[model samples]
Target: MLDSQSILNVLRPVQDPELQKSLVDLNMIRNVTVTDGHVSFTLVLTTPACPLREFIVEDCEKAVKTLPGVESVAVDVTAETPQQRSLPDRQGISGVKNIIAVTSGKGGVGKSTVAVNVAVALAQSGAKVGLIDADIYGPNAPMMLGLSAAQVKVQQSGQSEVLEPAFNFGVRLASMGFLIDPDQPVIWRGPMLNGIIRQFLYQVDWGELDYLIVDMPPGTGDAQLTLAQAVPMSGAVIVTTPQNVALMDARRGLRMFQQMQVPVLGIVENMSYFIPPDMPDKQYDIFGSGGGQRTSEELGLPLLGCIPLEMMLRQGGDRGIPIVVEYPDSASAKALTSIAQQIAARVSVLALA
Candidate 1:
């Protein structure tokens, strides 16, 4: 019999790669229908940015084709991001399912670039994404995300004020840059910084976001501590250039997250190599090579992906555009996009785990 029950029964053997559980049992396969030897169903994934989306779809098709009287398989794909487990001492932002931090050990590792591009990539894949430039003193995300001149709308929600985030490239953004003049410098101490981060977490009108990516300041400091203590995080990603000094700092940052009980998702090696404009065929490891892999191996973490150095990458950031948006086909853009997918995939795994 070519029916919905037969469809589900066939799909029961297809497990989600990351969750390692049967798709039908996980409620990922739904709305099964059959008519005239034709089959159709919805494949609700854990994340829109799932790296194995094509593979999963193909697997489902193969499984259904084996059933009798099946002419074709039509799998409509969608995603429902799962929420991170809550902590007794920490509070979660309403409407935000997962909060992940993108951090580097010391500064100048292009952490903001990685954070902004990753956020945009997730949003590009049909996920509701937000970014918090928690680097209060260096809120470069607004400029990098093409929203430097934009301002956050403040509305009084009862007694306290709730911020309306700026939007661009399908991402919601909150940053000190929106509040300060271009030439202004923030000279606040730990307490002031802590208060503002808390406000960003609880006082922002981030309506129904799948992932909120926090761009943390370099090093293990007050900003990291405040976030760790204040909210339940899905995970944290460490960004570092392929050098000994940067790798040392990355390790320090990773340990801080582990110590604070936040799952360290993975490490991203930025500026792993340089690709000259004229010679796209050649790659030079100006920052040394294989350092990210070695460090990840030593720390027992996955190396998410490595990004190359290109003149256009820096130009895109300075010109208020992310490389992923400006040059999607370039090597650096492709790497960042893959890294973003990897991050989303990891978050899905963590949520299910």
Candidate 2:
């Protein structure tokens, strides 16, 4: 017969694919029993329809079978209730009161950078805001917010409690990167991915704020679906460059939000052109111009603003300070501010109606 303790020790290395933590660490392993070289256990998944059910079951079976004298394994999976899922609940975020998701159809068009600056601009305009870095696979908000090395303090009270968000530049922020090793790759399936997102939304201690900006990963996938289902998003901002390929993806992103019933806030064209500071008259259309504007026109959404390509924008993002904060008077910074103002105005109108 397999010793229970021995079985547990063997399973210690097995981790939840999404949370990137051991089942023991997450308290997901339950009701372990052993008899006549056979083992049975219950695995409490974070969600009922866990997308990784087959993978998890296979992993559990393999882990248990490796135990001395264990011949067979039976794993029963169940999900926790929503209330049971959330730890100690904090006061809901008040004051500035809207949750917006900033997303892109594809990567590398400066989506994360745009998200950070938008949050910063909103904060600078006197609206309290929070930024949730929802891009689990590529969480760059921490680096952009100058908090790559920061950690969120997890509080407990009877049950696991709120995970306090780190603060940078007056905006409260949280990211999966803060909780995981920087170099670790997050390879998770749909269900597990959704659960992690839910955990971030319900378990985090997000205080009063006017807006909670979620930086979504590129592509219209499980992450986007989970976010749309989890939160009543105020609107979505589609970021794209003035290139055809980027615009194509941006259009898909806009359509995704629309299909999910979330309003399309507007489109912002980043790297629209290169303007020399000295010449101030010469404009270089590096990636081709007006793609974003034409897309917005076709979709019947506003073209919020166009951000000129500047070395300062890249420098600021790389240095953990948004261009808006580093050089508020710069053209790119001003453009972002204008975009923020337009969004705020639109949101206000929506609230009134």
Candidate 3:
């Protein structure tokens, strides 16, 4: 006879790779049954797109099979979208679970590109996602998401009026670009910048979101610092190119997040290499190579991915459809998707812990 207590004891050694917690300890084992020497149960996961799904399943089965009188093992795996377990609560934007800031040390490194696609990728995986163009001076999220002329609308949520965000590609977007003229420049001082950042968070009707990706302004400045302090950020994703100059600035960005006590999720190396259409067999080092890797090693962080320079990526952003959605099977899209998975995995692990 197979009982629940005996089954749980047998599976006590099985642990989630990311969270490092035993299945029994995490209460992931459910509906345990045994009849005629056959053992079956369900394993609840933190996220449906967990990168280590296979490993966890295999480990659970292996552990259960070790029990005596177990003829066959049947395991069903189910996942509930994990919540932001480790982050502090936001006062105004209390509906948001995870706040991720896609930032860099300097400008012109495809920070907006990375931020937009990552949000799309997470949404593609069946998670509710929102984006904020925190770069008040250069709010390109509206342009990137194909909402250049979109305007903010005021709606009554409960008692007071709230600003509504533009929606496209299944992601909610709010940016200063939609409110101001494209040709006009935002020549504002520091206090104004700070005030608008707060308004975007507190005034906007973001409703509910699993992850809110903030496309932060270039460089570490008052705006960046203010945003970090304003929200309870789950982590920060540092984007950089392989160029030495970009790496220098990227290092600063990584350290800035650490100094603020925000977890640095990982580093993404954009435009690491280029492959021309005419010569598919050969690879060119456009901005040098391994700068992201070197920086990740020095900082002791994970190098989430190395994206190559491709024409589709540039054209997709211009067309207002991110590469991840337009070219889901392309190499660039795959890299972004994998990075998103890693981010989800890290956040789920921390949340569960």
The most accurate candidate by TM-score is 1
Ranking by lDDT: 1, 3, 2
When summed lDDT is taken over every stretch of 10 residues in candidate 3, the lowest stretch is 81-90
Would you list the C-alpha lDDT of every candidate in the order shown? 0.86, 0.79, 0.81
What is every candidate's alpha-carbon RMSD to the true fold?
16.9, 10.5, 16.0
Q: How close to the true structure is residue 104 of candidate 1, measured as C-alpha lDDT? A: 84
- What ranges in model 1 sit over 4 Å off? 1-88
**Per-candidate clashes, comma-separated:** 0, 4, 0
lDDT per residue (tens digit) for residues 236-303 in model 2 = 88888898887667766764565445677898888899987776667899988888889888878899
TM per prediction = 0.75, 0.71, 0.72
Which pairs clash in model 1?
A: none
TM-score of 3: 0.72
